[model samples]
Target: MIRKLYDVIVVGAGSMGMSAGYELARRGFKTLLIDAFDPPHPLGSHHGEPRLIRHAYGGGAAYVKMALRADKRWLELEEATGEKLLERSGVLNIADPDVYSYEGRFEDAAVHGVSIESLDAQQIHERWSGVRLPDHFRAMYEPNAGYLYSEKCVAAYKKVALQAGATLLTHTFVTNIKPEKSYVTVSTKDDEFMAAKVILSAGAWFKTLEPFVHLPIRAVRKVVGWFEPSGKSFDAGAFPGFTFGNASGGYYGFPSIGGAGVKIGRHDTGVEWRPGEELEPFGTYPEDEDDLRRVLESFLPGAAGKLLRSAVCKYEFTPDDNFIIDTHPEFSSVLLAGGFSGHGFKFSSVVGEMLADQVELGKWGQDVGLFSARRFAQEDN
Candidate 1:
């Protein structure tokens, strides 16, 4: 027997899914959120303590605008829920001139009227003594950017979504998704549930639904670690969240908030992963700590004392490192949101709003043309 659940069913209530569920339910849609594990859990990508939120995105014009919308929505959510989900710690992006470029970011910021301060290596060092950069390095500081308590954000969304009359099923793994002509059936171990519309934001687990919706998304194992700081300057109040880009790769980090130490993670390079497979422990690979340590030692030596703790997460990547936020080609009722690459968490708020907009209005409210899965059609030929 199929239990017709609600107006919409959100699968994989992680960062994007949780926000989507919250938006859908709060807007008076009966929503059901099904998750394999209790959300805000460490098993997925959103568990890491803090994720960066930047406004002057280097990605593109649409990204910058989307980011601004997301920033507004996040603040609104915080105000509505009375939850301290975001921190206005600012963001600093440094790149070696010879190795990389920040021109695209500056252009995007200019086009969007986002404030970005140009800083040379000396200025960066003076502004944040903990940051040690080469004389040739250049930087852009977005004063309005900061970090989000990711897990807390998800938890808050879940709570508010439930209060808004959304049904949540935790620790229940989805076994299958069958999209019919008019409705979709989501099957779990215990029962089959049907909904008129569905939003799929399953992160790495999106692979499991290949039979119902095929997206060119791949999961990659990534790691992040907290390190003991050698000085108080690396504290959240004194230091800003930062990103460093060079010829080798890129790394992102946060200041020590609540004395949790400085959190650091490499933005590029990780092992390809599959669903249901175990992600080796953080230290399983020497580079997990060593790679992060090398960046800290080079730039923020003050924050490179020792490893406080570490965790592994997955990055659902698309072929072009863009995002896949479009409807399933086969089923218009099923909205697909995945392959955020690594910089997706910050936009969860707005992405959720757009997903819900697509369900209710037959199209995304924002200009998500760049994220259309149809862009991959050329590859098929």
Candidate 2:
């Protein structure tokens, strides 16, 4: 059988994979990106129209640099493609005043020089009349951080990657991967292709792929809902993207952009998903709408009129929610970039650059030790 060859083969042309292909193609590498479905499709995490981009990362202080870099790249892409990709609506985080609900977020902002404003509940309610929080809850507002038009961002990357000489095979599923001494072979049932290097970024289906079977990641199903607002107070132009959290749990949301209604979703609620199975629709479970309704009724009662629309997606989570963007332990030529958990779509641009740097220079420009897969190995000892 004949084998087609390229400099890099990126499996899973969704958010990270597509961006990596774009970066590699721009660097004059012969790249091929193969995906099971057309990207920016409704099946993945990047499907939702908008994704919040916060520089004062709640996850850890180490992420602020990557988040800032990703923000810059998003703006650069918007300028280059002339696409309306980022919505600068700002982001407001509501939590208890005394308790640091968002771990390391304040420290991250301080270390990165990212500006943020602290507001008490009364001040928050006064500024955004639609929001009603308990007096004990305080807020940290990042005026410069906002939400991205996620689907549009993926579409733009796909377009420019092709323009930069990258080849993409959409609706083509990779059945197996075999790493060799000099090259890696990717099989798609009917054909085989070889590349000098490969990026295994299969997202939610990461565990189902070979050479990654025991990668200690799980695919989980998640849902988000859009509700009709009672008035124009919830309009995207006037309202900001927001997060509400405490000792109980956390919920994140976006304002009604383009009359799409106020979109909301719980951050930590996810049901384990079996790979290769069709995703259950949004309303399959009662909590899908009920959980979101509970949040809206408690905080933004004005925006919880009726359920306008809903969608389901997947999240690939590691034991710890941090991402894993390192080389495969056994294969130097195969890079692994998955286990984003959640809160990763915002960093897709910078992550792609990091993976590209790893491919060409064999090292990342930034210290990504926090995301290394070896952390799990170390924990087991």
- Please give the CA lDDT of all the candidate structures: 0.90, 0.89
Return the TM-score for each candidate structure. 0.98, 0.97
lDDT tens digits, residue span 1-381, model 1: 556667999998998999999899989999999998999898888988899999998778888999999999999989988999899899999998898888988888887899889999899888887788889999989998999999989988888889888899999888888878778898998799889998999998988877777788889999999999987999998899999899879999999988999999999999999988998989888898999999889888889988988899989889999999998887788888999999999999999999999888887988988898888886788
Give the per-residue lDDT digits (tens) of candidate 2, residues 1-381: 678999999999999999999999999999999998999898778998789998998666668889999999999999989998888899999986565565468777988899899888899999999998888898899999899988999999999999999999988888888988899999997889999999988898776685544577888899999999988999998999998887657889999988999999888868998777889998888998999998899889999988998989888888899999888887888898999987899999999999999999989887788899788888999
Error of 1 at 104 (Å): 1.9
Model 2 misplaced stretches (Cα beyond 4 Å): 97-103, 211-213
- In model 1, which regions exceed 4 Å deviation? none
State the displacement of the C-alpha of residue 224, model 2, in Å, after optimal TM-score superposition. Answer: 0.7
**What lDDT does candidate 2 reach at residue 243?**
89
Weakest ten-residue segment in model 2 by summed lDDT:
96-105
